[model samples]
Target: MLCGVHNHDLAPNLSGHLLAGRLRGEEKQRVIDMTKSLAKHRNILTDLKEKNKESVTLI
Candidate 1:
């Protein structure tokens, strides 16, 4: 579920990447653990960028 904030309240970075929304409850804990797990490993950053690039091209 989304946080449901008004669109006008949302802001993007200078590069136009929108803010990753705030997380709450048990879902937030899960994301925290998942992030730590990803960080402990290698190549996640590269893999995400590569996947995003491929997705952009496909779009």
Candidate 2:
């Protein structure tokens, strides 16, 4: 008997994978827009964290 190792990981294109075969029409677009917004916010937060770290290191 042979078994395969399976990994449950989020796909690299998470937004597309999340929306694929799940949503359509306006709803899908809404989700995509929401993801974009969330990504923007995440980037902003990451920048802030890096800046905070730099300031802390300098002090």
Q: Cα lDDT of model 2 overall?
A: 0.45
Each model's TM-score, in the order given? 0.27, 0.27
For model 1, the superposed segments whose C-alpha errors exceed 4 Å read 1-22, 39-59
lDDT of each: 0.41, 0.45
- In the range 1-59, model 1's lDDT, one tens digit per residue, is 24866656534442323333222355346546657776532344344435444321110
| Candidate 1 collision pairs | none
Residues 26-56, model 2: lDDT tens digits: 5346546756777564554454436444221
Clashes of 1: 0
